[model samples]
Target: MKLPASGEGDVSPAVHHLVKGSAGGVTALFAHATGFHGRVWEPTARRLPGIDGHALDLRGHGDTVMPEGYDYPWAAFGDDILAAVDGLGRSGAGTGSGPVVGIGHSCGGAALVLAEAARPGTFAGLWLFEPAAFPPPAPGEVQHNPLVEPTKRRRPAFPDRSEALRNYTSKSPMDAFDPEVLAAYVEHGFTDEGDHVRLKCRPLDESQVYVSSLVANVYDAMAEVRCPVLLVQGAETPSGRFGKLTSQFPDARLEAHPDLSHFGPLTHPERIAASIRVWLEGLGTRI
Candidate 1:
Protein backbone atom coordinates (compact mmCIF):
# COMPACT_ATOMS: atom_id res chain seq x y z
CA MET A 1 0.00 0.00 0.00
CA LYS A 2 1.32 3.48 -0.85
CA LEU A 3 1.42 6.07 1.93
CA PRO A 4 1.56 9.83 1.35
CA ALA A 5 4.51 11.56 2.96
CA SER A 6 3.11 12.89 6.25
CA GLY A 7 3.53 16.63 6.85
CA GLU A 8 2.57 19.11 9.55
CA GLY A 9 1.45 22.75 9.57
CA ASP A 10 -1.31 25.05 10.75
CA VAL A 11 -4.71 25.15 8.99
CA SER A 12 -6.98 27.72 10.59
CA PRO A 13 -9.27 26.13 13.25
CA ALA A 14 -7.28 22.92 12.99
CA VAL A 15 -3.53 22.60 13.44
CA HIS A 16 -1.93 19.68 11.51
CA HIS A 17 -2.81 16.43 9.73
CA LEU A 18 -1.19 13.22 8.44
CA VAL A 19 -2.32 12.77 4.85
CA LYS A 20 -2.07 9.64 2.76
CA GLY A 21 -2.95 8.44 -0.77
CA SER A 22 -2.69 10.30 -4.10
CA ALA A 23 -4.28 13.66 -4.93
CA GLY A 24 -6.95 11.98 -7.00
CA GLY A 25 -10.65 12.55 -7.48
CA VAL A 26 -13.21 11.15 -5.03
CA THR A 27 -11.45 11.06 -1.68
CA ALA A 28 -12.61 9.97 1.79
CA LEU A 29 -11.62 12.14 4.75
CA PHE A 30 -11.70 10.66 8.26
CA ALA A 31 -12.15 12.34 11.62
CA HIS A 32 -11.46 10.76 15.03
CA ALA A 33 -12.67 11.18 18.62
CA THR A 34 -11.16 13.42 21.30
CA GLY A 35 -8.77 10.95 22.95
CA PHE A 36 -7.80 9.41 19.61
CA HIS A 37 -5.90 10.55 16.52
CA GLY A 38 -6.50 10.11 12.81
CA ARG A 39 -4.24 7.05 12.78
CA VAL A 40 -7.14 5.08 14.24
CA TRP A 41 -8.48 4.82 10.69
CA GLU A 42 -5.25 3.45 9.23
CA PRO A 43 -6.49 -0.12 9.51
CA THR A 44 -9.73 0.66 7.68
CA ALA A 45 -7.95 2.83 5.13
CA ARG A 46 -5.58 0.00 4.30
CA ARG A 47 -8.54 -2.22 3.49
CA LEU A 48 -10.38 0.32 1.36
CA PRO A 49 -9.73 0.27 -2.39
CA GLY A 50 -9.47 2.97 -5.09
CA ILE A 51 -10.53 6.17 -3.34
CA ASP A 52 -7.88 8.48 -1.86
CA GLY A 53 -7.87 8.49 1.97
CA HIS A 54 -7.05 11.45 4.22
CA ALA A 55 -7.15 11.20 8.03
CA LEU A 56 -7.33 14.46 9.92
CA ASP A 57 -6.45 15.45 13.50
CA LEU A 58 -9.34 17.55 14.72
CA ARG A 59 -8.71 20.68 16.82
CA GLY A 60 -7.00 20.04 20.21
CA HIS A 61 -6.43 16.40 19.38
CA GLY A 62 -3.56 14.40 17.93
CA ASP A 63 -0.92 16.68 16.36
CA THR A 64 -3.38 19.50 15.74
CA VAL A 65 -3.35 22.63 17.88
CA MET A 66 -6.64 24.30 18.65
CA PRO A 67 -6.97 28.02 18.04
CA GLU A 68 -6.53 30.32 21.04
CA GLY A 69 -9.64 30.79 23.20
CA TYR A 70 -11.35 28.36 20.87
CA ASP A 71 -13.53 27.19 23.84
CA TYR A 72 -13.50 23.78 22.16
CA PRO A 73 -17.06 24.21 20.94
CA TRP A 74 -18.39 21.36 18.81
CA ALA A 75 -19.31 23.84 16.05
CA ALA A 76 -15.67 24.94 15.90
CA PHE A 77 -14.71 21.34 15.23
CA GLY A 78 -17.20 21.33 12.35
CA ASP A 79 -15.55 24.43 10.93
CA ASP A 80 -12.14 22.76 11.15
CA ILE A 81 -13.45 19.83 9.12
CA LEU A 82 -14.70 22.24 6.47
CA ALA A 83 -11.26 23.86 6.42
CA ALA A 84 -9.61 20.50 5.79
CA VAL A 85 -12.05 19.72 2.99
CA ASP A 86 -11.49 23.14 1.45
CA GLY A 87 -7.75 22.68 1.78
CA LEU A 88 -7.88 19.37 -0.09
CA GLY A 89 -10.40 20.62 -2.67
CA ARG A 90 -8.38 23.76 -3.40
CA SER A 91 -5.26 21.62 -3.85
CA GLY A 92 -7.03 19.69 -6.64
CA ALA A 93 -7.17 16.58 -4.51
CA GLY A 94 -10.96 16.51 -4.23
CA THR A 95 -12.07 18.07 -7.50
CA GLY A 96 -13.21 16.06 -10.65
CA SER A 97 -14.97 12.70 -10.05
CA GLY A 98 -17.34 12.72 -7.05
CA PRO A 99 -18.01 14.51 -3.78
CA VAL A 100 -15.72 13.45 -0.93
CA VAL A 101 -17.16 11.08 1.65
CA GLY A 102 -16.79 12.25 5.25
CA ILE A 103 -16.23 9.29 7.59
CA GLY A 104 -16.08 9.95 11.30
CA HIS A 105 -16.04 8.13 14.66
CA SER A 106 -17.53 9.11 18.04
CA CYS A 107 -17.54 12.87 18.42
CA GLY A 108 -15.98 13.11 14.98
CA GLY A 109 -19.22 11.64 13.67
CA ALA A 110 -21.21 14.54 15.08
CA ALA A 111 -18.81 17.02 13.55
CA LEU A 112 -19.11 15.38 10.13
CA VAL A 113 -22.92 15.55 10.26
CA LEU A 114 -22.66 19.18 11.28
CA ALA A 115 -20.30 19.90 8.42
CA GLU A 116 -22.61 18.27 5.88
CA ALA A 117 -25.61 20.13 7.25
CA ALA A 118 -23.69 23.39 7.26
CA ARG A 119 -22.97 22.92 3.54
CA PRO A 120 -25.34 20.76 1.54
CA GLY A 121 -23.76 18.63 -1.20
CA THR A 122 -20.32 19.36 0.25
CA PHE A 123 -19.93 15.65 0.88
CA ALA A 124 -21.03 12.79 -1.35
CA GLY A 125 -22.04 10.65 1.63
CA LEU A 126 -21.44 10.17 5.32
CA TRP A 127 -20.36 7.00 7.17
CA LEU A 128 -20.58 7.50 10.91
CA PHE A 129 -19.63 4.99 13.64
CA GLU A 130 -21.45 5.35 16.97
CA PRO A 131 -21.27 9.12 17.24
CA ALA A 132 -21.75 10.26 20.88
CA ALA A 133 -24.73 12.51 20.27
CA PHE A 134 -26.81 11.87 23.38
CA PRO A 135 -30.13 13.64 23.90
CA PRO A 136 -30.13 17.18 25.21
CA PRO A 137 -30.55 17.72 28.93
CA ALA A 138 -34.06 18.34 30.32
CA PRO A 139 -35.20 21.91 30.54
CA GLY A 140 -33.61 23.83 33.47
CA GLU A 141 -31.25 20.95 34.14
CA VAL A 142 -27.46 21.40 34.38
CA GLN A 143 -24.84 18.67 34.15
CA HIS A 144 -22.06 18.59 36.69
CA ASN A 145 -20.12 15.53 35.66
CA PRO A 146 -16.36 16.00 35.53
CA LEU A 147 -16.36 14.75 31.98
CA VAL A 148 -18.66 17.62 31.08
CA GLU A 149 -16.86 20.42 32.84
CA PRO A 150 -15.05 23.13 30.83
CA THR A 151 -12.33 24.14 33.26
CA LYS A 152 -8.62 23.63 32.73
CA ARG A 153 -7.10 21.01 34.99
CA ARG A 154 -3.75 19.23 35.14
CA ARG A 155 -3.48 15.60 34.16
CA PRO A 156 -0.72 13.02 34.29
CA ALA A 157 2.32 14.07 32.30
CA PHE A 158 4.87 11.33 31.73
CA PRO A 159 8.62 11.86 31.83
CA ASP A 160 9.00 10.09 28.50
CA ARG A 161 6.96 9.78 25.34
CA SER A 162 7.09 5.98 25.52
CA GLU A 163 5.54 6.03 29.00
CA ALA A 164 2.67 8.12 27.79
CA LEU A 165 2.26 5.82 24.81
CA ARG A 166 2.29 2.79 27.04
CA ASN A 167 -0.30 4.27 29.33
CA TYR A 168 -2.59 5.12 26.45
CA THR A 169 -2.26 1.85 24.52
CA SER A 170 -2.61 -0.29 27.62
CA LYS A 171 -6.02 1.16 28.42
CA SER A 172 -7.45 1.97 25.01
CA PRO A 173 -10.39 0.21 23.35
CA MET A 174 -7.89 -0.64 20.60
CA ASP A 175 -5.53 -2.39 22.99
CA ALA A 176 -5.77 -5.57 20.91
CA PHE A 177 -4.51 -3.86 17.76
CA ASP A 178 -1.22 -5.01 16.22
CA PRO A 179 1.86 -3.59 17.87
CA GLU A 180 2.91 -1.74 14.73
CA VAL A 181 -0.50 -0.15 14.41
CA LEU A 182 -0.52 0.79 18.08
CA ALA A 183 2.94 2.32 17.69
CA ALA A 184 1.74 4.43 14.79
CA TYR A 185 -0.96 5.86 17.06
CA VAL A 186 1.62 6.74 19.74
CA GLU A 187 3.85 8.54 17.26
CA HIS A 188 1.08 10.86 16.10
CA GLY A 189 -0.79 11.20 19.40
CA PHE A 190 1.74 12.70 21.76
CA THR A 191 4.10 15.63 22.39
CA ASP A 192 7.39 15.78 24.30
CA GLU A 193 7.32 18.20 27.22
CA GLY A 194 10.98 18.10 28.37
CA ASP A 195 10.72 16.43 31.80
CA HIS A 196 7.70 14.53 30.54
CA VAL A 197 5.85 13.92 27.33
CA ARG A 198 2.08 13.71 27.51
CA LEU A 199 -0.74 12.57 25.29
CA LYS A 200 -1.70 15.44 23.02
CA CYS A 201 -5.27 15.50 24.25
CA ARG A 202 -5.89 17.71 27.30
CA PRO A 203 -8.39 16.75 29.97
CA LEU A 204 -10.10 20.11 29.91
CA ASP A 205 -10.48 19.84 26.16
CA GLU A 206 -12.09 16.43 26.55
CA SER A 207 -14.44 17.78 29.20
CA GLN A 208 -15.41 20.67 27.00
CA VAL A 209 -16.11 18.17 24.27
CA TYR A 210 -18.63 16.21 26.33
CA VAL A 211 -20.24 19.42 27.49
CA SER A 212 -20.48 20.64 23.94
CA SER A 213 -22.28 17.46 22.96
CA LEU A 214 -24.95 18.08 25.53
CA VAL A 215 -25.66 21.48 24.05
CA ALA A 216 -25.18 20.93 20.32
CA ASN A 217 -28.14 19.82 18.22
CA VAL A 218 -27.00 17.60 15.35
CA TYR A 219 -30.63 16.71 14.54
CA ASP A 220 -31.52 20.33 13.98
CA ALA A 221 -29.31 20.40 10.91
CA MET A 222 -30.20 16.99 9.44
CA ALA A 223 -32.69 18.42 6.95
CA GLU A 224 -29.92 20.50 5.39
CA VAL A 225 -27.99 17.44 4.23
CA ARG A 226 -28.39 16.59 0.55
CA CYS A 227 -26.59 13.25 0.33
CA PRO A 228 -26.94 9.66 1.42
CA VAL A 229 -26.02 8.89 5.04
CA LEU A 230 -25.11 5.55 6.56
CA LEU A 231 -25.19 5.41 10.34
CA VAL A 232 -23.47 2.31 11.78
CA GLN A 233 -24.41 2.09 15.40
CA GLY A 234 -23.68 -0.37 18.19
CA ALA A 235 -26.71 -2.48 19.06
CA GLU A 236 -25.99 -2.10 22.75
CA THR A 237 -26.64 1.63 22.39
CA PRO A 238 -30.13 2.43 23.62
CA SER A 239 -32.50 3.35 20.80
CA GLY A 240 -33.39 6.75 22.17
CA ARG A 241 -29.94 7.74 23.46
CA PHE A 242 -28.49 9.60 20.48
CA GLY A 243 -31.02 12.40 20.74
CA LYS A 244 -33.56 10.06 19.07
CA LEU A 245 -32.20 11.91 16.06
CA THR A 246 -31.88 9.19 13.43
CA SER A 247 -35.48 9.74 12.27
CA GLN A 248 -34.69 13.32 11.27
CA PHE A 249 -32.73 12.50 8.11
CA PRO A 250 -34.71 12.23 4.90
CA ASP A 251 -32.28 9.82 3.25
CA ALA A 252 -30.60 7.77 5.92
CA ARG A 253 -30.06 4.10 6.75
CA LEU A 254 -29.08 2.56 10.03
CA GLU A 255 -27.16 -0.69 10.58
CA ALA A 256 -26.63 -2.01 14.05
CA HIS A 257 -23.96 -4.59 14.89
CA PRO A 258 -24.91 -6.36 18.08
CA ASP A 259 -21.47 -7.57 19.05
CA LEU A 260 -19.58 -4.42 18.23
CA SER A 261 -18.83 -1.68 20.72
CA HIS A 262 -18.32 2.02 20.12
CA PHE A 263 -14.88 1.23 18.71
CA GLY A 264 -16.28 -0.64 15.75
CA PRO A 265 -13.79 0.70 13.20
CA LEU A 266 -10.79 -0.23 15.31
CA THR A 267 -12.12 -3.49 16.68
CA HIS A 268 -13.78 -4.58 13.44
CA PRO A 269 -12.37 -2.55 10.62
CA GLU A 270 -12.80 -5.27 8.03
CA ARG A 271 -16.47 -5.72 8.90
CA ILE A 272 -17.08 -1.98 8.91
CA ALA A 273 -15.13 -1.52 5.70
CA ALA A 274 -17.04 -4.30 3.99
CA SER A 275 -20.32 -2.78 5.11
CA ILE A 276 -19.20 0.61 3.80
CA ARG A 277 -18.07 -0.91 0.48
CA VAL A 278 -21.44 -2.56 0.03
CA TRP A 279 -23.24 0.66 0.91
CA LEU A 280 -21.18 2.72 -1.50
CA GLU A 281 -21.71 0.16 -4.24
CA GLY A 282 -25.45 0.41 -3.67
CA LEU A 283 -25.15 4.14 -4.14
CA GLY A 284 -23.96 3.42 -7.71
CA THR A 285 -20.39 4.54 -7.04
CA ARG A 286 -17.90 2.39 -8.95
CA ILE A 287 -15.66 0.72 -6.41
Candidate 2:
Protein backbone atom coordinates (compact mmCIF):
# COMPACT_ATOMS: atom_id res chain seq x y z
CA MET A 1 0.00 0.00 0.00
CA LYS A 2 1.00 3.63 -0.55
CA LEU A 3 0.70 6.46 1.99
CA PRO A 4 1.38 10.17 1.94
CA ALA A 5 4.86 11.30 2.88
CA SER A 6 5.34 12.02 6.60
CA GLY A 7 5.85 15.73 5.76
CA GLU A 8 8.24 15.92 8.70
CA GLY A 9 11.21 16.56 6.47
CA ASP A 10 12.13 16.83 2.77
CA VAL A 11 10.72 13.40 1.98
CA SER A 12 9.12 11.98 -1.11
CA PRO A 13 5.39 12.35 -1.63
CA ALA A 14 4.65 8.64 -1.11
CA VAL A 15 5.36 5.82 1.34
CA HIS A 16 5.12 2.06 0.59
CA HIS A 17 4.23 -0.76 2.94
CA LEU A 18 2.90 -4.33 3.11
CA VAL A 19 -0.03 -5.77 5.10
CA LYS A 20 -0.78 -9.34 6.12
CA GLY A 21 -3.83 -11.16 7.57
CA SER A 22 -7.29 -9.59 7.25
CA ALA A 23 -8.81 -11.36 10.23
CA GLY A 24 -8.20 -8.37 12.46
CA GLY A 25 -8.10 -8.88 16.17
CA VAL A 26 -5.11 -6.83 17.31
CA THR A 27 -3.20 -4.75 14.82
CA ALA A 28 0.63 -5.14 14.92
CA LEU A 29 2.63 -2.44 13.20
CA PHE A 30 6.16 -3.54 12.31
CA ALA A 31 9.20 -1.43 11.44
CA HIS A 32 12.29 -2.99 9.94
CA ALA A 33 15.98 -2.34 10.58
CA THR A 34 17.79 0.05 8.30
CA GLY A 35 18.41 -1.26 4.76
CA PHE A 36 15.65 -3.84 5.12
CA HIS A 37 12.16 -3.75 3.62
CA GLY A 38 8.87 -4.35 5.46
CA ARG A 39 8.16 -7.74 3.88
CA VAL A 40 11.09 -9.23 5.76
CA TRP A 41 8.71 -9.53 8.71
CA GLU A 42 6.48 -12.04 6.89
CA PRO A 43 8.10 -15.08 8.50
CA THR A 44 7.34 -13.83 12.01
CA ALA A 45 3.93 -12.33 11.19
CA ARG A 46 2.69 -15.65 9.84
CA ARG A 47 3.69 -17.42 13.04
CA LEU A 48 1.17 -15.50 15.13
CA PRO A 49 -2.41 -16.19 14.13
CA GLY A 50 -5.20 -13.58 13.95
CA ILE A 51 -2.91 -10.56 13.86
CA ASP A 52 -3.45 -7.65 11.47
CA GLY A 53 0.21 -7.04 10.69
CA HIS A 54 1.20 -3.88 8.82
CA ALA A 55 4.89 -3.71 7.95
CA LEU A 56 6.21 -0.35 6.82
CA ASP A 57 9.07 0.24 4.40
CA LEU A 58 10.77 3.11 6.17
CA ARG A 59 11.68 6.00 3.85
CA GLY A 60 14.57 5.20 1.48
CA HIS A 61 14.19 1.47 2.04
CA GLY A 62 12.07 -1.00 0.12
CA ASP A 63 9.68 0.44 -2.45
CA THR A 64 9.22 3.83 -0.78
CA VAL A 65 10.34 6.64 -3.06
CA MET A 66 12.58 9.44 -1.84
CA PRO A 67 13.13 13.01 -3.02
CA GLU A 68 16.44 14.28 -4.34
CA GLY A 69 18.63 16.13 -1.83
CA TYR A 70 16.58 14.77 1.05
CA ASP A 71 18.69 13.70 4.02
CA TYR A 72 17.33 10.74 5.98
CA PRO A 73 16.73 12.22 9.40
CA TRP A 74 15.67 9.67 12.01
CA ALA A 75 12.66 11.82 12.98
CA ALA A 76 11.29 11.56 9.46
CA PHE A 77 11.21 7.78 9.86
CA GLY A 78 9.05 8.23 12.96
CA ASP A 79 6.70 10.45 10.97
CA ASP A 80 6.58 7.73 8.34
CA ILE A 81 5.28 5.41 11.03
CA LEU A 82 2.69 8.03 11.97
CA ALA A 83 1.58 8.29 8.36
CA ALA A 84 1.21 4.53 8.06
CA VAL A 85 -0.72 4.32 11.31
CA ASP A 86 -3.08 7.05 10.09
CA GLY A 87 -3.49 5.37 6.74
CA LEU A 88 -4.28 2.10 8.46
CA GLY A 89 -6.82 3.78 10.69
CA ARG A 90 -8.51 5.35 7.68
CA SER A 91 -8.68 1.94 6.02
CA GLY A 92 -10.16 0.33 9.16
CA ALA A 93 -7.07 -1.77 9.79
CA GLY A 94 -6.46 0.01 13.08
CA THR A 95 -9.82 1.38 14.25
CA GLY A 96 -9.89 -0.35 17.60
CA SER A 97 -10.16 3.08 19.25
CA GLY A 98 -6.89 2.63 21.15
CA PRO A 99 -3.19 2.79 20.44
CA VAL A 100 -1.82 -0.24 18.61
CA VAL A 101 1.16 -2.39 19.59
CA GLY A 102 4.49 -1.87 17.82
CA ILE A 103 7.09 -4.49 16.87
CA GLY A 104 10.40 -3.13 15.67
CA HIS A 105 14.08 -4.03 15.27
CA SER A 106 17.31 -2.01 15.30
CA CYS A 107 16.71 1.35 13.63
CA GLY A 108 13.01 0.49 13.45
CA GLY A 109 12.91 0.12 17.22
CA ALA A 110 14.40 3.57 17.70
CA ALA A 111 11.91 5.01 15.24
CA LEU A 112 9.05 3.55 17.27
CA VAL A 113 10.42 5.30 20.35
CA LEU A 114 10.62 8.56 18.43
CA ALA A 115 7.00 8.16 17.32
CA GLU A 116 5.69 7.46 20.81
CA ALA A 117 7.63 10.44 22.14
CA ALA A 118 6.47 12.77 19.37
CA ARG A 119 2.87 11.81 20.18
CA PRO A 120 2.00 10.29 23.51
CA GLY A 121 -0.43 7.35 23.38
CA THR A 122 0.52 6.59 19.81
CA PHE A 123 1.27 3.02 20.87
CA ALA A 124 -0.12 0.83 23.62
CA GLY A 125 3.07 -1.18 23.87
CA LEU A 126 6.38 -1.71 22.10
CA TRP A 127 8.49 -4.87 21.57
CA LEU A 128 11.92 -3.68 20.45
CA PHE A 129 15.01 -5.66 19.40
CA GLU A 130 18.24 -3.82 20.16
CA PRO A 131 16.73 -0.43 19.36
CA ALA A 132 19.45 2.04 18.40
CA ALA A 133 18.25 4.65 20.90
CA PHE A 134 21.28 5.57 22.96
CA PRO A 135 22.09 8.16 25.61
CA PRO A 136 23.46 11.49 24.38
CA PRO A 137 27.21 11.53 24.24
CA ALA A 138 29.00 13.26 27.13
CA PRO A 139 30.64 16.65 26.76
CA GLY A 140 33.35 16.60 24.05
CA GLU A 141 32.56 12.94 23.33
CA VAL A 142 32.20 11.79 19.76
CA GLN A 143 29.92 8.97 18.57
CA HIS A 144 30.52 7.18 15.32
CA ASN A 145 28.70 4.38 13.48
CA PRO A 146 31.21 1.75 12.36
CA LEU A 147 28.80 0.35 9.77
CA VAL A 148 28.66 3.53 7.69
CA GLU A 149 31.88 3.06 5.80
CA PRO A 150 31.23 -0.62 5.08
CA THR A 151 27.67 0.09 4.00
CA LYS A 152 28.90 2.63 1.47
CA ARG A 153 30.88 -0.11 -0.20
CA ARG A 154 27.95 -2.51 -0.49
CA ARG A 155 27.22 -3.74 -3.98
CA PRO A 156 24.27 -1.91 -5.52
CA ALA A 157 23.36 -4.28 -8.35
CA PHE A 158 23.21 -7.98 -9.04
CA PRO A 159 22.57 -10.16 -12.02
CA ASP A 160 19.46 -11.59 -10.36
CA ARG A 161 17.98 -12.78 -7.09
CA SER A 162 20.00 -16.00 -7.33
CA GLU A 163 23.23 -14.08 -7.59
CA ALA A 164 22.29 -11.77 -4.79
CA LEU A 165 21.40 -14.69 -2.56
CA ARG A 166 24.66 -16.43 -3.34
CA ASN A 167 26.66 -13.30 -2.65
CA TYR A 168 24.99 -12.60 0.68
CA THR A 169 25.04 -16.22 1.77
CA SER A 170 28.79 -16.26 1.38
CA LYS A 171 29.22 -13.15 3.52
CA SER A 172 29.35 -12.60 7.26
CA PRO A 173 26.16 -11.25 9.08
CA MET A 174 23.82 -12.19 6.23
CA ASP A 175 25.14 -15.74 6.27
CA ALA A 176 23.61 -15.99 9.73
CA PHE A 177 20.10 -15.18 8.52
CA ASP A 178 17.43 -17.85 8.36
CA PRO A 179 17.26 -19.30 4.87
CA GLU A 180 13.58 -18.43 4.43
CA VAL A 181 13.97 -14.94 5.80
CA LEU A 182 16.99 -14.26 3.62
CA ALA A 183 15.03 -15.47 0.61
CA ALA A 184 12.32 -12.91 1.33
CA TYR A 185 14.95 -10.21 1.72
CA VAL A 186 16.37 -10.96 -1.69
CA GLU A 187 12.98 -11.34 -3.32
CA HIS A 188 11.50 -8.01 -2.22
CA GLY A 189 14.53 -5.84 -1.46
CA PHE A 190 15.48 -5.35 -5.08
CA THR A 191 13.92 -3.97 -8.25
CA ASP A 192 14.35 -5.35 -11.72
CA GLU A 193 16.16 -3.40 -14.36
CA GLY A 194 16.48 -4.19 -18.06
CA ASP A 195 19.64 -6.22 -17.63
CA HIS A 196 20.20 -6.40 -13.88
CA VAL A 197 18.54 -5.98 -10.51
CA ARG A 198 19.32 -2.92 -8.41
CA LEU A 199 19.01 -2.64 -4.70
CA LYS A 200 15.97 -0.58 -3.70
CA CYS A 201 18.04 0.96 -0.90
CA ARG A 202 21.00 2.51 -2.63
CA PRO A 203 24.41 2.18 -0.97
CA LEU A 204 24.74 5.91 -0.40
CA ASP A 205 21.27 6.18 1.10
CA GLU A 206 21.81 3.25 3.42
CA SER A 207 25.18 4.61 4.49
CA GLN A 208 23.52 7.89 5.38
CA VAL A 209 21.01 6.00 7.48
CA TYR A 210 23.86 4.58 9.53
CA VAL A 211 25.34 8.03 9.90
CA SER A 212 22.02 9.44 11.14
CA SER A 213 21.67 6.81 13.84
CA LEU A 214 24.48 8.21 15.97
CA VAL A 215 22.96 11.70 16.21
CA ALA A 216 19.32 10.64 16.71
CA ASN A 217 19.33 10.02 20.45
CA VAL A 218 15.86 9.39 21.93
CA TYR A 219 16.87 8.17 25.40
CA ASP A 220 15.55 11.21 27.27
CA ALA A 221 12.33 11.32 25.30
CA MET A 222 11.67 7.72 26.31
CA ALA A 223 10.58 8.97 29.72
CA GLU A 224 7.37 10.24 28.10
CA VAL A 225 6.57 6.73 26.84
CA ARG A 226 4.10 5.43 29.41
CA CYS A 227 3.45 2.22 27.54
CA PRO A 228 5.15 -1.03 28.53
CA VAL A 229 8.23 -1.95 26.53
CA LEU A 230 10.13 -5.21 26.08
CA LEU A 231 13.71 -4.83 24.87
CA VAL A 232 15.18 -8.03 23.45
CA GLN A 233 18.78 -8.65 22.53
CA GLY A 234 20.97 -11.60 21.71
CA ALA A 235 23.61 -12.58 24.24
CA GLU A 236 26.23 -11.74 21.67
CA THR A 237 25.17 -8.09 21.51
CA PRO A 238 27.09 -6.15 24.14
CA SER A 239 24.80 -5.73 27.13
CA GLY A 240 26.51 -2.49 28.00
CA ARG A 241 24.71 -0.66 25.22
CA PHE A 242 21.27 -2.32 25.48
CA GLY A 243 20.98 -2.96 29.21
CA LYS A 244 20.60 0.66 30.19
CA LEU A 245 17.58 0.91 27.89
CA THR A 246 15.28 -0.66 30.48
CA SER A 247 16.14 2.08 32.96
CA GLN A 248 15.20 4.87 30.54
CA PHE A 249 11.57 3.90 30.19
CA PRO A 250 8.73 4.15 32.71
CA ASP A 251 7.79 0.48 32.31
CA ALA A 252 10.27 -1.66 30.44
CA ARG A 253 12.32 -4.87 30.82
CA LEU A 254 15.13 -6.59 28.99
CA GLU A 255 15.12 -10.09 27.49
CA ALA A 256 18.17 -12.00 26.39
CA HIS A 257 18.54 -14.81 23.84
CA PRO A 258 21.83 -16.56 24.47
CA ASP A 259 21.51 -18.50 21.25
CA LEU A 260 20.56 -15.58 19.04
CA SER A 261 22.36 -12.49 17.76
CA HIS A 262 21.30 -8.88 17.22
CA PHE A 263 19.54 -10.06 14.07
CA GLY A 264 17.64 -12.72 15.98
CA PRO A 265 14.35 -11.75 14.37
CA LEU A 266 15.72 -12.47 10.93
CA THR A 267 17.89 -15.37 11.99
CA HIS A 268 15.21 -17.23 13.95
CA PRO A 269 11.72 -15.99 13.26
CA GLU A 270 9.96 -18.80 15.13
CA ARG A 271 11.83 -18.10 18.34
CA ILE A 272 11.25 -14.36 18.11
CA ALA A 273 7.57 -14.88 17.30
CA ALA A 274 7.12 -17.16 20.29
CA SER A 275 8.60 -14.55 22.58
CA ILE A 276 6.36 -11.86 21.08
CA ARG A 277 3.30 -14.08 21.50
CA VAL A 278 4.06 -14.68 25.16
CA TRP A 279 4.57 -10.97 25.82
CA LEU A 280 1.41 -9.94 23.97
CA GLU A 281 -0.59 -12.59 25.82
CA GLY A 282 0.75 -11.39 29.16
CA LEU A 283 -0.63 -7.97 28.23
CA GLY A 284 -4.12 -9.61 28.15
CA THR A 285 -4.38 -9.55 24.40
CA ARG A 286 -6.31 -12.41 22.82
CA ILE A 287 -4.12 -14.55 20.54
TM-score winner:
2
Across residues 216-269, which tens digit of lDDT does each residue of candidate 2 receive? 857877788888899998874443777787889998998988788788999999
Model 2 CA deviation exceeding 4 Å by range? 9-24, 95-99, 236-239, 285-287
Model 1: worst 10 consecutive residues (lDDT sum): 1-10
- What ranges in model 1 sit over 4 Å off? 1-25, 67-69, 137-146, 149-155, 172-181, 285-287
Residue-level lDDT for 73 in candidate 1:
67
TM-score for candidate 2: 0.92
Clashing pairs in 1: none
Error of 1 at 146 (Å): 6.5
- Backbone clashes for every candidate come to 0, 0
**Candidate 1 residue lDDT tens string, 1-287:** 11222222334433233344444445788888766778777777777776677777777787676644446667767777787777765565543465588888888888888888887777888888877565556799784445564335635467776775676577655576556556777676668777766767776676667767666777577667768888788765554553355666777778778788776776777887798778767765523
For each candidate in the order shown, give its overall lDDT on alpha carbons. 0.69, 0.82
Candidate 2 — which pairs collide?
Answer: none
TM-score for all models, in order of appearance: 0.82, 0.92
